[model samples]
Target chain A: MSDLKIIKLVKNFVGMDRPAVNNVNLKINSGELVAFLGPSGCGKTTILKMITGLFAPDNGDIVLDNKSLLPIPTEKRGVVMVFQNYLLFPYMNVNENVGFALKMKGIDKNVIEKKVREMLDLVKLPDIGFRRPKQLSGGQQQRVALARALIASPRLLLLDEPLSNLDAHLRDEMRDLIVTIQKELNVTTIFVTHDQEEAVLLADKIALIFDGELQNYTSPKNYYEQPKNIKAAKFFGGVNFIKSKKINNEFISDIGKINYVGENINDLNDEINITVRPENIKLSKTNDFDHNSFKGNIKSIIFSGTHTRYKIIINNLELECSLQSLGIKNINQGDEIFVHLPKDKIWGMND
Target chain B: MGGERLKIILSLTPPLLIIITLFFGGIFYGFLQSLGYQPAIGKYDINFSAYYNVMFSERYSKLFWTGLGLNLWVSFASTFLAAVFALFGALAIRKTFFAKTVCNFIYSLNLPMPHLVVAVGMIFVFSQSGLLARFASQLGLINSPGDFPVLVRDKYGFGIILAYIWKEAAFFFIILMSVLQSLGENFEELAQSLGANRWQRFRYVILPLVMPNLFSASIIVFAFSFGAYEVPALLGVIYPQMLPVMAFEFFLNPDLNARSEGMALSIIIALIVMILVVFYFWLTQAKIRKD
Candidate 1:
């Protein structure tokens, strides 16, 4: 079992003022696919590199299966990283590239060949083994890279923005392939990406990092429904924030009072900002909910292909709400509407 | 299309003219002379006598064969050693910015120096009565300058090989540095992640990635050292003289008839370089295809 734990990992670049990765901690169970999600230069890839033993953490331990991996060399760490550019060895054919790790292990040639063929089939590129990496398309190269990494059967698989190089369609295809392979092999995997959709779609747990610190590490749903701070909420597309103050357990805002229900508000400061996802704010023509309902006027409506987004004005506060296009037929600009801010869906953060 | 084609041809005409007339024209004239054609000396007949004399005749065969051996030995040894030294040097410094900058400056310092100057430098530094020998004598490590080991003008062409290595390793280093810089550490990192140790990473990834460039560079170095005259002429011994030095000696003969043999030797040197380059290309291409 390759359960991995990173405790207070820190890395400070020489010239930078702040640490590139600072005080980040995470625990990933065996066979659990986790994503280190953040924007560019947010230390997501730095964390991945540290885990792969490419970069040593300044002050922490990376434990895999109850053993500290700090002293192990990169090759002996049994951690494989697929680089962002899919850096396949240009001199080797696809089969040779896939079998390179096994060859390094002094495995038998026939056995390597058979395993390489099986890996090729696993990545769904069985017929292209003899072709060189340059001969393959971007998606095919990505598959070859994946096949090469997985063939090593690494204790931990690290992918650095593997799908960021692919087109839209290939991204979806590779996403499914990664999930399938990660589950099939039961390897503890951590992939770094700035794409939140990819993180939510692939990872069993998402570690949202911002500016070298772990903001929140939880299931993907928690990032949307219960973000740790306004920054974490904003990163996951939480935009409708209501500036408020918690007085006697009631969130008193400009619009109205919102009853607290989701998490304990004792830790939150009196001055707080509560936010709800645009899609979570229920918009209706009539007041249906007994609590946290506000009457508002629809200021604007944008009809996208799948969803229609509406900007509603309530008590001089403009709030954005998105509804499925199918159910948003009657909604139009300048129409009065009653929007319900569900107590359970509203996430509060101290300013 | 016709206008564009004419414009391209017009642009290329000058260099093409110089290449065809001066370069190939010189080679053709040399080839005709090597075949014993000498209109200047009141002889217009073309024959294979000069080639036969250089290759098989009793008068010149021993010198020709030994000269060829020395030429091969010096060229192969210098080129191989230079390439190996440059490869290691480049790998050592490729990861460091300051070291790379300083080394690049120091390494390219010799590239512009003429081979004759390098040969003279080798003699001054490595010869029996030179600076190193005098220093060794002063240190009491050697009894006298005469006790110093012979390097310059030695029978083994040590000084000649040394001069070439000193100059050519810079060339190899520059080529290798640019290649390794462009390659970065991505492939090596990928190999490392795939469980390849240091030696395995170098053997499987770094070496192959740089092979094509290194192969082409080695070809240029090999062909150059094989045919170059200055270092070998200044530092080579008498009996097993390099082919270029021996060919120059033949050309210096006042009897103009011996010029044909000189031309034959020069043509033989060119032919050998061409054949070897083509053979090397074929061997590498076949290996690449098989791989």
Candidate 2:
């Protein structure tokens, strides 16, 4: 049980003055699933590759369990990576491909077949042993690749944007498959992805990286309720930023003076960006907002299946509010409404 | 008709014209002339003496075996050397920048240097009074320069095969390198990630990807070697003559009847290449079925 520890990791590509991954320190205990999340080119994949030894770090060390892995070659490193393309061996069928790693380890044919069969069953691909990768569907091939990686029972499992290759619907299915498989096997896992929803669904802890720097590493609920800075706040996508001045660590925006929401309430300051999630936003026709409420006109109303997604223009600021249509009438576009932003749910960040 | 619609005969005409002019016309004229219907010889009547001479004459029969046997050896030997060289060149370039640049320069240089120039240079170095022969005599490997059976115009055909490898290996190198390079990064990387060592990656991923390109390149280079003329004449004119040499000998003969024999030999060489191409296609089909 090698617990992966990456200390002061850095990777600078040739001819580029800037490092893609700079001074990153992260560790995963045995059986812990840690996810790296950010927008594209935030160096999440570079970090994962370095961990897998596909790319070497310019500076720092990777310590596994009780030993330092400086002398161990990549082939000896008992760490397997599952790429987004699945990288299935084109010439080998499911059984042969899945048993390749075991064969390389000098495992007997009888043992390899037994282990491969168990892995196939684990990834729900037991019936695909005789089929080539091209013959299987995208989802089925992903399962085979998972079986191939999992059968080796690697000490560390690195997944680089694995769900990004699938369609939107199938991406959701792969997400559950990855988290469930990782938990059941209890492999020390590191999943790198740009999808915030994926990070939220699969990670026990999410590290938000921006410009090759770690901004926040915390639980999903904490990340939503307490983003450390403006960059981390903007990446989650549907948050409304209301610019305001903080007096005595409370933001006074179009909504009103609001205090801290969930976690990191101690990090509030004089100038802030108040983030109100669409789910917490309330809209009414009266100007009865007290601590953190504002007068806003609904500029647009779009139906998003379960709720009405409203684009509200409050004075000079814009806000996104969602109203679940549970026997409620349709909120027409360009309707003047008073938006009530909850003081407790507002993550006021000092940019 | 739509503007994009293909003209049916336009695509058909070039190959059809090529087959008629290069194959049919040459065969028809050669066949008639070989039967001894030569206006130049003041005999407009057909006779089977040229074919009979080819079948019965002791000297012509010896020349035929020497040329045909040497032709097969030169073809297969050069193909083997070129395959090994191309594989090494491709593998060397895959890991280093300067090695790749140097190899690119060498292979590209080989493409434009004509075979006759290469053969002439080889003769300059391998002849009896040549630098290599002189050095070998001084080193006591041979008693004299003349004692070194000159590779040029020898029964062994060493110089001819060298020239063939020089030109055709570069051609195979370029195609095989691209095939070896474009074998996507993920398969090899994923195999390593799956605990395969470097040799395992080569055996499982690299070799399988490049084998098809190797087979195709072999056939192409073999054709180029078989149809060759200048190098074979320059290097092996004394003994074990190649098919092209035999054709040229008959073509330049003083007897008008022997000129017809040259055309028949030319047609035979062409048929050999044609049969090999057909056989190559059939073998690859069988391999695919076995897979």
Candidate 3:
């Protein structure tokens, strides 16, 4: 019941030429875990702060449960944010820190104690309640922070780079814990992260931002398969871009006539940029596709641990292609190969 | 490791030797004199008569007890008020960039001022027949300059406490500002997000986070105000004076035997400060253990 909507959000910082967050709009359903995915300084954290009422937006309306939250102060907004460093109160032990919200609400001591124990069990750290935050490891502190935030039963839980401070193993562990708790409570959550893999793996929907603007907001699969713009495609690791002109349902580029299978292909602008993921480009010994296949000489081959990367030159156009190492059997540098651009994979963008 | 340890000890030797010989040597000499050893008067003996005379003798005990009371009252009140004022001031200005810059400049201006100068300034501003008294008389608030209440050289040590608060608040403010700047607004923001209002945020997050620094600074302020002679001597009253002023009066006496009592009183002041500091640490440590 805690659906959140951000409409025409704009915030301008002093001394900056452009806004830090400009006219960003988003709708998040209740119980859905949304990720505000962007690079550093792209205003993802700003939007989170505005929602938490730490920063007031210059022009916007943030509505929670169909009620405007713009006039509410931060403490009354029913939104809690776990900071990047997990700012646990250094003076308090784990029990006091976790029970602080209830204590603030003037709840009874025994109730708070019981709830604190329950939260400790939920976070899987029942015996460490007497230790100070300084005594905990980084991952343990993160869990304590999560416990504290959840103990409040907030309407919206915002996490700012929750896994950025953890090692790879702890990151995976905390990711699972977060997903588990987020579902168990069914709280609407939005976490800001720059890591694309974390966003893709954890988010029900990813809101990609760039230069203080919403680049694209969609499901993870669509964000990768059908990026809305060239920047979104580039951010998702789409490296091979060909400047093409759309004429009569065919895209003419330096590589060849690119054919894409999608509705509204003819409705695109006259000039557009065509891009496909490197992994999506099929490289084979024989010309498998009839319309969108080309023979190219492999200029270089790099054998990574999981995949093999190849740089192929086709008609003065160098295209990067990656294939599974197990699938790449007889490919070597300086070999003639046939690269096929799948009709359903080629994406056309006007920007 | 041996060479590194030797280098560290060698580097520390100069300051250590200076402190041991000059500082501790002075205290040792003073302690001996307080125990009734006077080489200048050809009297070398160790006894407790000086301490007894200062604490129990009929002639000086009354003055000693009252002076001790005044000293304690002034030190504790001034130190606590100054720390509290500086903490609120720091918190108020920590969020604004321009205000913080301007307030920092203004606050630091008082830190370099001497206590004697501040005491004199206090007298001029607050004493009867001074600038404030004359101004009040002119403004028709009072009949004459004498109608203004006595502040400086008053029996209550208001003028002395005022001077100490004015000077020490700046010191506490500087320490608090550095701590608050380093802490930033993260803890307060976290508390706010947890549904704590303004007072709760200050009470829980801000107070505890700054407590250690404030406690240490308060200890230094308390110890200094208890022992310092300049401001109280300039602005204190005669009947019930601070310990340092009364001690200096004993040193000014012509009888050389009075120096023993003065040394004993000085030692008593130092011992009281040390005991109070230990007690403060014990109280805070007990609280920490409970937490």
Candidate 4:
């Protein structure tokens, strides 16, 4: 029963020059689900390990439940981890696996059985008590790992990409399952995942990390709308940008003069990297559209099920735009079209 | 799939043939000889006399049971000690590079030591006025070699157990290290995050998960030590006439009949180890359920 606080945690892998985790400090309040979202080798998993005391920090302290956890071993910290592989203890059956912590506590068998069954029911795997981990599907095994962690009534539950191993459809379902389950259990949890969408969908707070540094930690809305830096904007908005100069109150790039949207983050330093959204940059047959125009040759048009993305090379600048084409867009490759980009649709980063 | 199956069977043929010749053929021959229906002798005496003599001779009774008991005790005791050493060796290599390199080099040396060399090495290190006693005397820690104490050739099979542990622990360390490594860092992190203490994590996660391989390896080590001839003959002072030692002694007899009894004794020792292994399988299955 503790609120977890990490203060200036650093870990250096011996024999490796670069620090895997460099001076990471983050806090998870009680009953919150924060995600450590990063690509592989971003030190997200390593940070989780340090919190669980699986890896001792080369320096700094971890405070959990008003006590310094640096001196405490992992098992005594009251934090449970659900691994990416689900790690259900292959030699153990589901009941024993779920009730493992209680068994360690030397609890009565009857109570252990009761708690295990209750947890199994909570994970909606009520009939899987006698089955081994290998017998269960990836999703079901993930459920069991969750229940095992939750049944311990842990202070915090750390998930190291539990849904990554599942299939696409199953991954979606399990993401919802984890969120619903965490809300029901109200355990302060941090999920470590490389998948950006998984992090956005599952986390109340998304901490986007890159190269062992926290890029931005914010809610999903702010993360997309107002990115802190170029890395944040690039990852969250999925935008395409071109280096440009801010002269005559417009972005002069290879494409054309993109109308400068200066209402937000127009703080021009010396140079500007402006992003033209693929969706916002439109292509139409009308030559008279009152917008910055470029005569683009239709290079290619990819027809997705519900939408089409057009690749246009205008003035030797390849510009891509997504169209919500519902089965019809009288557009073909090698056709001439006018590309219209509104002033407000352009986002620029001061470099 | 069919071609793969064929390839697997074809690959297995050589090992299957070796198993048939070395294991089954030996067992079949022993069975025939023990029954006293020796085709080579041109005799088919339907009598339990050889069995009775092998089973109930006063020397056989005294030597076989005592040696069997001693072998069992030493094998188990040594395996336990080896397991402890392997655990320490594993933990030592868990995080530190220096400890890892030295421990690994020393432990890996165990498997490479031949029985002859191991026995000779034991003589050089553990015998009376050997390297240990010589060093102790020079250090002025002991008055004489007798005061240096009986480590090797000790009456309680302490010497055999020590040598067995020294050799087997290193050999088993490699196996144990692989098992621990294969489980990887994630599972331990999972256990700790689940609020499992170091002991609890080890007991609940690490031990339970790897127990299957560990138990199997332990039994293999057990059987190896039980039937081993060189170590017991050379270093075993607690029971000079240990089962394998007694078997060697009987086999060296001038009378051909005495050698046949020795084979029968060998057959009995093999059966006991096989039964013990079967029991181990049963025990492990139950443990798997509990896990």
Query: Compared with the true structure, what per-residue lDDT tens digits does model 1 show for residues B84-157?
Result: 99999999988888999998999879899999999999999999989999999999999999999999999889
Tens-place lDDT digits, model 2, residues B235-269: 88666679888788889988766887787677678
lDDT of 2 by residue, A1-351 (tens): 768787888889987668898888877789989889988988998887776778888898889996766567677888899888888887788999899899988999999999999989888877889887778989888888888888888999888888888898888887898889888989988888998988998899999998888888888877777777777777776468878786665556665556555465566566667787888887777767675556768788888788878898877777887788776554678877777877677776777
Higher-ranked by DockQ: 3 or 4? 3
- The whole-model C-alpha lDDT of candidate 2 against the native structure comes to 0.81
Q: Measured by C-alpha RMSD in angstroms, how accurate is candidate 3?
A: 2.3
Worst lDDT 10-window in candidate 3 chain B:
B282-291
What is residue A137's positional error in candidate 3, in angstroms?
1.3
Prediction 3: B-chain TM-score: 0.92
The local lDDT score (0 to 100) that residue A256 gets in candidate 3 is 77
DockQ of each two-chain model: 0.73, 0.60, 0.73, 0.55
RMSD to native for every prediction?
2.0, 4.1, 2.3, 4.4
CAPRI quality level assigned to candidate 1 from its DockQ score: medium
Clashing pairs in 4: A2-A65, A75-B195, A75-B196, A75-B197, A79-B193, A80-B193, A80-B194, A92-B291, B155-B238
Of the candidates numbered 2 and 3, which has the greater TM-score value? 3
* Model 2, docking class: medium
Q: Write the per-residue lDDT of candidate 4 for residues A243-345, one digit (tens) a residue.
A: 7776766667877676665566447754677666677777877686777777889999898867798889877878788888874558899999998867666
Quantify all predictions' global Cα lDDT against the true fold. 0.92, 0.81, 0.93, 0.79
Candidate 4 accuracy as lDDT? 0.79
Error (Å) of candidate 4 at residue B254 is 3.3
